[model samples]
Target: MALLAYRDKHILSAQQLRKLSEHKYSCFSASLLDPLLQPWWNWLVSQTPLWLAPNLITIVGLILNVVTTLILICYSPNGVEAPPRWTCLLCALGLFIYQSLDSIDGKQARRTNTSSPLGELFDHGCDSISTVFVALSACISCQLGHYPNWLFFQCFCAIALFYCAHWQTYVSGTMRFGRIDVTEAQFSIIAIHLVSAALGPEIWLTKIPIVGLSWNYTILVFITFGYTLNIINFLKMFTEGGSGKNGSSVAVSIASTSRNNEAKNNYETCMKT
Candidate 1:
């Protein structure tokens, strides 16, 4: 009976299916390293059964991230002592699993022929919360909590950068995850965790004499630069006539049009399959 209800819920009319098929619902993101990993991802997606729901995968990923975050918080470094270096490895394992699961959820949706705008929204919303968990865990793993208020700042920067990227996507009708995207960022975080496990978290806290910046701050600088570049890209799109509309009136029109079009396209695409 439950299976019957599930099937009924996803069933779509022919006209609705056609509209979905013609609509372009998927986001367009260019990541420098994605191509290299595509084959592995494809294989994993193929192995996932269509009976499983994509949102369930997303929830599982979120749960893993949440557990990691809780562990990091418990292990947060004190001025006198650091978390057991081995715990960093645990964090890394959780992050890797979270990223892998996150990647596959979309594939699951596509496989099940149940992709929809709501699914995209649900995926992205979970991503936002996951971003916070990742940032906090990374900061703690790196011993950045030793510096007062710095950990909060790191979390804020991570969330703000992600929000900025999404905002650009909304306005420009194009999604650019940046030259260095979330996937790359997650891998970098994983690497940091491994390094901390090997060399100790103090390694990240040590300041370079010449630059007067620690490893943590230096990474933050790079993140800031990437978000700044995202902003520039958005401005470029606007000045160069994004959405192919022009003049002062274009701003209002494009804003509403792009949003509606994106939602409509995603809805159609999801239902079409």
Candidate 2:
């Protein structure tokens, strides 16, 4: 109960705040969702059906991501103008769903004693795969809306840099990713939604008497920032390899086992089915 109220005002729950404290990272939608997610996470853990099932939710998210990609691809190459509002809205919805499910499985595991080595590997592996889905969809959507091809390349740069930086962070340490500090990655994806939202005449930024200026520069400004952030993170790890590490987060490999034992012991003490 206290945790719920604390989370309401704090922006991130204790787990997330602790994660960031450990890893110290940021991203857009990730920051926003930090507050709303914990309650759902706690609830998921409390439920037997929803407890730490990695393959199920991960696949669901993957499929939705694919659906979003396909929608964008359908629009790509044609450069059609004034695509329906519903199309843009639908894509936004897909992205929203993606964010909601992103961190739940891990939370579920920790809370419910479902954590395991196989689960960790599956979750991390799928995260890498999902990055591809975002880039492909963004490129296709822009093309379909008659947007610039450059946008897709910008997306590519951001994703590539992030991908490299993530692996680099792990390599510099114990080859592990933190659950809480995932804000940076999610915000990176949010950059896509922000830029993709720009579709019409007002999309321009500047007005020169002879030359017209538009918001692309503003949008590009965000793109540049995202890329820069990736570079900075990569460099930090490249130079120092992130705090020399106590060790790899190898404990998480046995997290599931730990949880199961705890649950069993609790049941024995309680004598309840």
Instruction: Work out the TM-score per prediction.
Output: 0.76, 0.60
Off by over 4 Å in 2: 1-37, 40-48, 78-82, 139-149, 174-212, 242-273
Residue-level lDDT for 15 in candidate 2: 54
> Per-residue alpha-carbon lDDT of model 1 for 73-112, expressed as tens digits?
7767442246778778888998988888888898888788
Best of the candidates, TM-score: 1
Separately for all candidates shown, the number of backbone clashes (residues 3 or more apart, or on different chains) is: 2, 12
- Candidate 2 C-alpha lDDT tens digits along 41-131: 5665456365336567777877787786566556543434433434444665676666656667666666666666566667767777777
Tell me the deviation in Å of residue 192 in model 2: 7.0
Q: List the residue pairs that clash in candidate 1.
A: 20-268, 115-270
